[model samples]
Each structure stands twice: as structure tokens, then as C-alpha cells.
Target: MRSEEEVFALLIGFAKSDERIRLVSLEGSRANPAIADDEFKDYDIAFFVTDMESFLSKDDWLDFLGKRLILQKPEDMELYPPQLGNKFSYLMLFEDGIKIDLTLVPISELQSCLKRSDGLLKILLDKDNTVKEEIVATDQHYWMTKPTAQKFTDCCNEFWWVSTYVAKGLARQEFLFAQDHLNQIVRPTLLLMMSWKIGAEKGSSFSLGKNYKFIQHYLAAEEWELLLQTFQGSGYSETWEALFLCQKLFRTISKKVALAYGYDYPNYDERVTPYVQGLHTKCS
Candidate 1:
């Protein structure tokens, strides 16, 4: 595996050698000073180039990076439509186990790139001094913010409403369908409510990390255990248990958040809970 220094040297060296590759910047977790350094962190790089077509014209240029175990060109794929307009990316995992998500941006789009940036960027090379201001990287853009009354009510409503789908699927013995709704909709909505409660207590300056990965650090021991219980086994009984726990946890946290913010908590849970309970009773 290539060391971080070796990877940086190679990336910077390649950018300097190619006049077409005018500017290079590192983005994502690598650029954020708050994030701890780890081997798993991908080299999220952006290259502002003179001619994107010339680079796209051949696969040989990427050979200079490393011997890839596999590569995914999102823009070149049919199944997943490209989301980055006027930009292309190569998601490469080298044989040595280092992954690099390198994006190529047209030089003409530099201003727009800066505008769309999430404030986590460290410029490595700018040959023409195109960037006059200092690029201070911060993860503040991703930090948790206080939720509005409307947003809080909406989250509660979504949680209670979609939860019915989970009950319906389980009542029909459609395990996969129930699991999908629980995992995709119900749990995410619960997480949102949890994060709002965290924000209310901790203030809005800190982040819970992507997908609230750092959420457990903030939760109470019993609450955390309950949250874990919501991720249950394959059995229908277990799925029902998970759904009930999710409802209980969401109700507890959301009410606290509502109290803190003085927002009127919606009564959807009052109506939805009995419906779900009835379905479970009928199925049993």
C-alpha cells in the first residue's frame, strides 16, 4: 500500500507534469482538519483541466495513477445516470487497497465550482493564480442545524405515515417489503428526529457525521441500546418488535425536541400507533 506522502507526491507530480491539468484541489474528509486521518479515507481530488475531451479520449492517462483493482466511471455508465454536469469522475480502487475518487472539472467552470463547493477544499496547485482568496477547509457546512417547526412536524408525520407500510408488509408476510420500508424510510426518519434532539441539546455547531454515524456518542446508554434493538432479526415477530421500538424511541426524542423548541408536536403517532397495533394483533 502507498503511504499518504507517496500518494500526495504522485498526485501533485502528475498535476505539475501535465500543463493541461492546471489546478488540483483535495476535497471531502481529506480536506477537513477536524476529521482524523485514516487509511480508509479516499484521496478525493479534483483536477481543473484545459481540455476534458483529451483526457476522456483515452484510458492510458489513468495508468499513471496506479494499477487499479477496479474502476467506475459514473458518467460513462448507462444504469446510473450522470449527476455531475460538465464534470467527470473516476472512482478507482488500486491493487494496493487505496481508493481515489478523482474528478475532472473544466477550467471554464472554476468559478461555478467554487460557488458549489461545500467549503471542504484544499487547493494543491493553481498555476495561473486563478484562486485569489484563501481556501479554508471546514466541515462546518455539514454541521447540524436547529430544525424549524414545520420541518420537525414534517419529520414526525413522515415517520408515522410510512411506518404503516412496514405494518402492512409484515401483516401480509412480505418480509423483504417490510424490511425495506423499515430500513429505508422509518429508520431514516427516526434518525432525523434523533439528530434534531441532539442538536437541540448540544447546540448546532457540531456535526453528527455523514448519515449520523457519530450519533451513538451523543445518545444515552439505554437510548442507544433501544436504537440498536430497532435493528432486529429476520423473523416476523422480530420485525414487529423493531417497528414498535422505533415508534417508542421516535416518540420520546421528538417530544423532547418539540418541548425544547416550543413546536407543537403532531398527533399522527396517536392515530398511527393503534392501526399498526391492530395489524400486528390480526397477523398473530
Candidate 2:
């Protein structure tokens, strides 16, 4: 579609022409120095403004940006329940394929924004020069941290222990519940353990990207393929296969992390796998 320069020119030009829009900052991947720029990257813009309500009341101004494909106003709706506290957001996908997650916070919150920013932010336009220091965007918050010995033990214990919940749901033929356990609880534990291994091998200062999306870059081809296998079909047999493989991967990665730090693997692993294995037999 359009070039990044063209899109940003439109954004900055629009903000500059509007007196109510006091400040602008770019956030997320677009602002991350370590991330390569791409069309799919969202223009995560925040406008610290004078009249938040009047802006929230209108959709006409956004029309000049692009033809709207679909958009979400999280703070305006009740069903999804807002998570930004006092902030309002417009999650937009343009007809031409540009995405912008624009947030509107009161000008009064400028100090609060600066104080709480995750560091992946660049101030674009500040009318009153509210920000004193230079903002350098960094993905330092998502870096792989070296887990403590106790933390290593906790990760291992959580992985093996929660895995049994997947077995419980599967044995009851509750595919959705089992899948939730596999996707939400079990997979995150596996990801964290894998990240710990990455931290040990590489330096613990670099990020693996959101949701471990960059993890495959560090994983062996066969290991990555096996990790993919941990996501199986809806059938009980398939989920059982997935759970078994999850245990295998977790055991391998977590053991390395623990041994590197001299952390003890929990007794739960000794008991839980077989406990789940026995329970799973009922599904057959």
C-alpha cells in the first residue's frame, strides 16, 4: 500500500493542524528500534488532548485517514469491558491495509503517561514540550530474564502440575476445556521454560518478541516441529498425543534450565504424569 513516510506524514500533519491534539507519541512495534519495519506493523499513536469527549463523539475526522474496514472503540463499549482504565482506544484497520491502535488520554495525564511508559515509545509532536528528557524506544521490558533457583523450581512445578488439568478435561470429553488448558495454561508454561533456556544460551537481555513469536529463530528445526505437534486436533486421542508431547518438551527444556542453575525438579512431575496417564485411560 502506501509508504511508511506517507502514512506518518498524514498522521503528524493531521495532529499538527488540530489545536486540541496537544501531544502525539508512537508505541508498539513501530516505535521499537530492534524491530524491522513492515507494512503489517501498526501505527500505535497516542494523542494527549484537550477535549477527549468531543473527539470520542465523532468518527468524521478518522474518515480522512483511510476507508475504514472495521474498528473497535473499547472504552465506548460495555460488553468487552475496558482494560485501559481511564484511556480510550480506537483499534482501526483501514481499507488499504494500514492498522492504527490510537489511544486518547487527557492532556492532564501526560505526566502519568511519561511515568508509566514501557520505554517502547517515541514522542512525535509536543506542543507545550511536556516531556523534558529524550525518549528512546527499547524492547527491554520483554527481555529474557534469568530466573532465580526458586523461580526455576516454580516454573517446573507449575508446568507438570497444570498439565493434569488437560488430562482431566480430555477424560471428561470436554474438548474446549482441555483446549483452553492446553492453549492458555500449559502452553505459556512451556513458552516460559523455553525462554529460560534461551536466556541461558544467549544473553538474558534480549527479547523473544510478543507471545514468543521469535522463539523458532532460536529453536532447532526438529524441536520447533515437535513443538508445533503439541497443538493437536479436537479429538481425545489427538489431545492426548499433544499432552504427551508437551510433557516431553517441558521435561527436556525445564531439566536443562534447572540443572544449569542447580534447581531441583519438583516431585509433582514424578506423580502427575502417571496420574494423568491413568486418568486418560478412562477416555478410551
Candidate 3:
């Protein structure tokens, strides 16, 4: 694997040599001060260019980076529609085991990019000093936020409503359908409620990381164990057990959050619980 210094030097050197590449910035975890350095962290680089077309037209220049294990041009692919409007990105993994997510941005879109930035960006090179303000990268943009009353109610509603789909799927013995609703809808809603509770308890100043990946650090040992149990869905009985555990955890945390904020906790869970339990009994 290439050293971080070696990779960064190569990236900066390449940008300096190219006149079209006016500015370069590092984004994502590599730019965040709070995230511990790791070998798996990608070099998330953005090049604000005078002409995006010049870079988009050729792959030959990418050889300057390294030998690739695999490369994906997201905007160029047909199967996956491009989501980055006016921007193109290359996701590359080199044979040397270094990965880089390089994005090309038109100079015209720099202001718009800054507006949409998640506060995790550090400028590496800026020949023209296009960005006058100091760019200090922080994970603050992704921090947990206090939920509004309506938002809290909606989260509770979604969890209980979609949970019915899981019950329906399970009663019909459609394991995949049951698992999809459980994993995709019910659990994410539960996580959202859990995060709100965490924000209330721990202060909304810090994040639980993307997709709440860092949540385990904040969870109690037993709670984390229960949360893990919610993922077990290999069999019909296991899925039912996981669904019930999800309800237990979500209800426990969400009620605390509602009490802290003096918001009314809805009775959706009360109504949904017995309905799901009745289905479980019927299935058994």
C-alpha cells in the first residue's frame, strides 16, 4: 500500500502540473479531524477545473495515479443513473491497495458545491485562491440534531405503520418480503428514534456517524446486544423475535425523548403491537 504522504504528493503534483485543474480539495473522512486515521480511508479528492469536459473525455491521464484493481465512473455508467448533477466522479482502487474517490467539478459550480458541502472539506491546492475563506473540516454537519415535535411523531408513525408490512410478510411466510420491510423501513425508523433519544441525552453537538455506525459506542452493553438481536432474521421465529425486540427498544427510547421534550408520544405502537402479536400467534 502507498503511504498517505506518497499518495497525497502524487495527487498534488498531478494537479499542479495540470493547468485546467485550478483547485483541489480533500473531502469525506480523510478531511475530518475527529475521525481516527485508518488504512481503509479513501483519498476523497475534488478537482475544481476550468473545463470538466477535458478530464471527462479521456481516461489516459488517470494512468498518472496508479495501476487500478478496478475503476468505476459513476456518471458514465448506464445502469446506475448519475446523481451528481454538473459533476463527475471516479471511484478507483489501485493494485497498491490505495483507494481514491476523485470528483471533477466545473469552476462555475464551486459556490454551489460549497453550499451543499457537509463541512468536511480541506483545500489542498488553489492556484487562483478561488476560495478566500479558510475551510476548516469538521463532522459537525453530520451531527445529531434535535427532532421537532412533528418529526418525532412522524418517525413513530412510520415505524409502527411499516411494521405491519413485516408482520404481513411473515404471516404469509414470505421471508424476503418480511426481512426487507424490517430491515429497510422498520429498523431505520427505530434507529432514527434512537438517535433522537441519544441527541437528547448526549447533547446534539456530535454525530453517531454515517448510518449511525458509531452508535454502539454510545449504547449500553445490553441495549447494544438487543439492537444486534434485531438483525437476526434467518427463520420465521427469529424474524418475529427481532420485530418484537425492535418494538421494545424503540418504544423505550422514544418515550424518554418525548418526555424530555414535553411532546406527546403517539399510541401507534399500542395499537400496532397486539395486531402484530395476533399475526405471530396465527402464524404459529
Candidate 4:
């Protein structure tokens, strides 16, 4: 595995040597100072290039990076639609176990790129000195905002309502619907509630990291263990246990958040818990 220095040196050196790539920048956690340093973090690089299509036509250029174990070209695929609209990217995982999500944007699109930028962008090389503004990286845009009373109520309501979808699917023996609700809706709401609790305790000024990755830092050991259990097995029995745990955690966290902010905790939790419990019992 390449050291960070070796990786960056190879990364920057390659950009410096290539005239087609006129500028380079880093994005995501690698650009944020507050994130605890981790070896597994990917290299999220953006190269402002002269011709993105010209590079997309070739395979040999990427060979300079490292021996890639596998790589994904989202823009080149039919199954997955391109999300970057005007840009193209290669998501590469090298044999050395380092991953780099390198994006190619035309030099002409620099103006639009700056406009759509998230706050966590750090410029690495600007040979043409096109960037006149500050490129200092900050996670300010991602800090949790204190939810309004209405927003808090809505979050609680959504969690409890969508939970029925999980219970219904489990009762009907439809694993996909149950798993989807648990993963896509139920877990996200739990994370949202957890973020609110963490924000309330931590001055409402820090990030919980993407998808609540840094949440364990604020959660008690027991609470974190409960969270781990929520991601356990997926059989009907296991799914019910995880769903029940999710409800318990969300209830505690959301209730605390509502109380701290003087917002009303919904009365529906009392009714829904037993209803889901009945479904699980029926399925059992």
C-alpha cells in the first residue's frame, strides 16, 4: 500500500506532467481538517481538463496511477445514469487497496463548478491561477441545523409511519420491501434523530459525518452496541428485532431532542410500537 505522501506525490506529479489536465483539487473528507485521519479514506480528486472526452477515449493514461483492481466509469455505463450532469469520473480501486474518485471537468466549466461547490473543496494545483477566490476547506455547510418544532414533528411522524411498511412486509414475507424500508427510510430517520441529539449536546455546530459515520463519538457504548444490532441479520426474525431496536433508539433520541428544544413528542409512538409488535408476533 502506498503512503499518503507517496499517493499525493504520484497524484500531483501526474497532473503536473499532463497539459490536458490544467488544474487539480481535492474534495470530501480528505479535504476536511476536523475528520480524524484514517488510512482507508479515498483520494477524491477533481481535474479541470482541456478535453474530458479525449481522456475518456483512452485506457493507457490511467496506468500511470497504479495497477487498478477494478474501476467504474459511471458516465460510460448504461445501467447507471450520470449524476454529475456535465462532468465525467472514474472510480478506481488500485491493487494496493487505495481508492481514488477522480472527476474530469472541462476547463470551460470552472465558473459553474465554483458555483455548485460544496464547502469542503481544497485546491491542490492551479497552474493557470484561475481560482481567484479563497479555496479554504470547511465543513460549515454540513453542520447540523437545529430543527424547527414542525420539522421535528415531521421527522418523528415519518419514522413511525414508514415503520409500518417494514412490519407489513415482514408479515407478508416480502423481504425486499421490509429491507428497503428498514435501510432506506427507517435507519436514515434514526440517524437524523441521532444527529439532532448529538448537535444539541455538541453546540449544534459539528458534522456527524456523511450518513452519520462519526455518530459513535457522541453515542454511549451501550447505545452504539444497540446501533450495531440494528444492522444484524435480515431474516424475518432478525429483521423484526432490528426494526424494534431502531424504534427504541429513535424514540429515546427524538424524545430527548423534542424535550430539549421544548417541542412536542408525538403520541403515535405508543400506538405504533404495539402494532408492530403484534405484526411480528403474527409473523412468528
Candidate 5:
């Protein structure tokens, strides 16, 4: 297995040696200073090049990286529409357990690239000096922002309102519908509330990392255990348990957020909870 430094050196060396590739930049976790360094962090690299299509035409060029366990070129594929917009990528995992997600972009698109970037970026090489300033990686973009009163109320309303859809789906025996409501709609707001609680505990200024991954830092041991329990959804029985846990977690987090920030939590006991309990009885 190549060391992280060795892999990074090779990536930079490759970019420096190629004239078509005028600049190189690193993004994602490697660029995020808040994230604890680990071997599993992927090398999210982008090469600012002269001609993206010229590089895409060749298959053997990528052999220099490593023996690919599997590779996915998103722009080259026909099934899913590409969101990259003028950028091409190689999502490659090497046989030696190293993964590198490399993207190719035309140098002409640098203006737009800077605007869309998540603010965690590091320049590795630049032959033309297209970048005017030094880049420092930070997780500032993923920080838990102080929510406005409207935003807080909206989050609470969304969590309590969408939850009824889960109850409706479960009563109708539409497991897929229930799963979507719980997973896609309600869960994100629950996660957001969790982040706000963490932010409140930590002076309302620190980041919770991407998707609130650092939330466990502020959570009590029993709360974290309960949060973990919410992820178990093997069957209908487990789905009910998961929904119940979501309600419990959301109630706990929202009250903390409301008290800290002067927001209002929905009346779960008088409204959604009993309605859901009745739906569960009817469905059973």
C-alpha cells in the first residue's frame, strides 16, 4: 500500500509533468482541517487542463495511477445524467486499498469553479499561475449556522408535519412510502436540530462537520446510544421502533434548541404523537 504522502507526491508529480494539465487542486476531506486524518480519506483531486475531451478519449492513461479495482467515469456513462457540468471524473479504487477521485476541468472554467467550490481547497501545482492567491483548507462552509426564528419554526414544522405522512403510509401498508417519509423528509430536519443543539452547547459557532458527523461530541452517552438505535430498520417492527426513536430524539433536541434560541416546538403530545399512536393501533 502506498503511503498518503507517496500518493500525494505522485499526484502532484503527474500534474507538474503534464503541459495540458496546467493546475492541480485538492478538495473534500483531505482539504478539510476539522476532519481527523485517516487512511480512509479519499484524495479528491482536480486537474485544470487544456482539453478535457482529449484526455477522456484515452483508456490506458489512467494505468499510471494504480491497478484499478473498479473505476467509474461519470461523464462517459449514459445511464445517469451528469451533474458535474463540463468536468469529467475518474472514481478509482486501487488494488492496494487506496481510492482517488480525480476530476478533469478545462482551465477556462476556473472562474465558475471557484464560485461553486465548498471553500475547502488546496492548490498542489500551478504552471500558469492562474490562481491569484494561496488556498487554505477549512470546514467553515459546513459549520452549524445560527438559525433565524423563521428557519427554526420551519424546521420544527417540517419535522412534525412530515411525520404524519409516515403514520399515513404505515397505516396504508405502504412500507416504501413510510420509509421515504421517515428517511428522506423527516430525518434531515431531525439531524439539523441535533446540529443546532450541538452548536448551542459549543457557543453556537463551531461546525458539526458534514451531515452533522461530529454531533456525538455534544451528545450524552445514553442519547448517542438512542440515536444509534434509530438506524435499525430491518422490518416493519423495526421501522415502528425507528420512527418512535426519531420522535423521541426530535422532541429532545427541539426543546433544547427552542430554550436556547427562543424557537417553538410543535405540540407533539397533544398532536402528532397521539395521532401516530392511534394510527399504529389501527394498522396493527
Candidate 6:
């Protein structure tokens, strides 16, 4: 494993030597001061260059860095579809265990990059000073914003209402569909409500990070355990247990959010409880 200083020095040195590469900016956890540095943290780097074609045309250019275990060129592929305009990316895992997500964007698209940037940006090399404004790399992009009245009501509605889909899927013995609705659609709303509670506890100005990864740091022991239980899916029995656990956790978290935020819990919780109980009885 290469030291952070060595890896970073190599990155900047590469950019500095290449005339095609004008500006280099780093993003993600590596650029976040709040996050502790670790080997697992990717060197999320972007190089603002002149011609994207010459670089995209060759794979050997990557060999200049080091031996890579695997790499992904997003813009070059058709399957996932590219979101970044005039930008090519190489998500690389080196043979030595270093992971670097390197992107090459035309300097012309620098404005667009800044617009979409999550603010966790640091300019490593700005030869021509192509970057117009200074970037303040904060986690502001993922902040637990004070939800609008409609957003609050909508989340409450979604969490309680979509739960019936899980009940229906379970009754039909469609475990995958049940788990999908329960875990994907319904669970996110529950997580949002939980974040709202955290925001209330601390301040609404802070972020919980994406997928509520940092939520456990703020959540109570029982809450964390219940949340963990909500992920219990492997076989049919496990899926059923997970669905039930999800229900319990959702009810607990949503009630707190409803009370704190003055949002109404929808009436569907009453309908789904018996429906799920009946299915459990039938399955037994």
C-alpha cells in the first residue's frame, strides 16, 4: 500500500508533467477534512484537459500510473450510460490495493463541473487558473435540510402508504417484491425521518451523509439494533423476519418524526398490520 503522500505526489506530478492536463481537482472523502484519512478512501481526482479524445483513445496511458487490478471507463461504455458531459472516467483498483477514481473533463466543461460539484473539492494543480472561483469543500451538499411542509407530509404518506405494498407482496409470497418495496422505497423515507430526528437533536444545518451511513453515530442502541434487523433477508424465513423488523422500526421512527414535525401518520398502518399478521398466520 502506497502512503497517501506518495500516491498524492505521484498524482500531482503526473498532472504537472502533462501539458494536456491543465487543472487537477480532488473530491470525495479524500478531500473532506471532517473524514479521517484511510487507505480505503479513493483518490477521487479530476483532470481538466484540452483534448479528451487522445486520452480516451488509449488504455496504455493508465499503465503510466502503476499496475491496476481492474478499471472502469464510464464514458467509453454504453451499458450504464454516461452522465458527465465531455468527461471520461477511470475507476481503478491498483494491484497494490489503491483505488483511484480518476476523471478527465475538458477545461471547457469546468463551469459545469463546478455546478454539479458537491463542494468537497480541492484544486491540487491549477496551471492556467482555469477554475473561476475558490471551492469550499464542506458536506453541505448532503445536509439534512429542513423539509418543506409538503416534503414532510409526502414522506409520512410514502412511509405508511407504500408499506401496504410490502403486505400485499408478502401475502402473495412475492418475497423479492415485498423486500424491494420495504427496503428500497419505504425504508428510505423512514431513514429520512430518523435523520430529521437527528437534525432536531443537534442542528438542522448538518449532513447525515448519503444512505444515512453516519446515522448510527447519532441513533440510540435499540434504534440501531432495530435498523440492523430491518436488513435481515436471505431465505424466506429471513425475509419475513426482516419485513416484520422493518415494520417495527418504521413504526417507532415514523411516530417520533410525525410527533416532532407535526406531520400526520397515514391511516394505512392500521390496514397493513392485520393484513401482515393474517399472512404470517397463513404461512405458519
**Top model number, lDDT:** 1
> For residues 107-209, what per-residue lDDT tens digits would candidate 3 score against the true structure?
8888898888999999999999888999889999888888999999999999999999999999999999999999999999989888888888889888888
- Which residue pairs of candidate 4 clash? none
**Which sections of candidate 5 miss by over 4 Å?**
none
Which 10-residue span in candidate 3 carries the lowest summed lDDT?
A: 51-60
Model 3 lDDT, full chain set: 0.92
**C-alpha local distance difference test of each model:** 0.93, 0.87, 0.92, 0.90, 0.85, 0.82
- By summed lDDT, which 10 consecutive residues of candidate 4 come out lowest? 232-241
- Superior candidate under TM-score, 2 versus 5: 2
- Model 3 / residue 125 / CA error / Å: 0.2
Evaluation by lDDT, superior candidate among 1 and 4: 1
lDDT of 5 by residue, 1-284 (tens): 89988998888888878889998999998888778898888999999999887898887888888799999988888898888988999999999999999999989998788878888898888898778977777767777778888888888888888989988887887889999989898888888888877778786655776666777888889888988888887777788889999999889888988999877666654588899889888877
For candidate 6, the clash count comes to 0
Sorting all predicted structures by TM-score, with the top scorer first, yields 1, 3, 2, 5, 4, 6
Off by over 4 Å in 6: none
Q: Candidate 2: where is the Cα deviation over 4 Å?
A: none
* lDDT-better candidate, 2 vs 5: 2
Segments of candidate 1 deviating more than 4 angstroms: none
Model 4 misplaced stretches (Cα beyond 4 Å): none
The superposed Cα distance between candidate 2 and the true structure at residue 206, in angstroms, equals 0.8
In candidate 3 the C-alpha lDDT for residue 196 amounts to 87
Tens-place lDDT per residue, model 4, 1-284, is: 88989988998999999999889989998999889788899999999999887898887898889899998999889998889887899999999899999999999998888888788888889999999988888898898999999889989999999999999998999998999999999999898988888888787677888878888889989889999999975488899899999999998989899888999999879989899989888877
**What is the C-alpha lDDT profile of model 2 across 45-77, one tens digit per residue?**
998999988887888888768888999999888
Q: What lDDT would candidate 2 get against the real structure?
A: 0.87
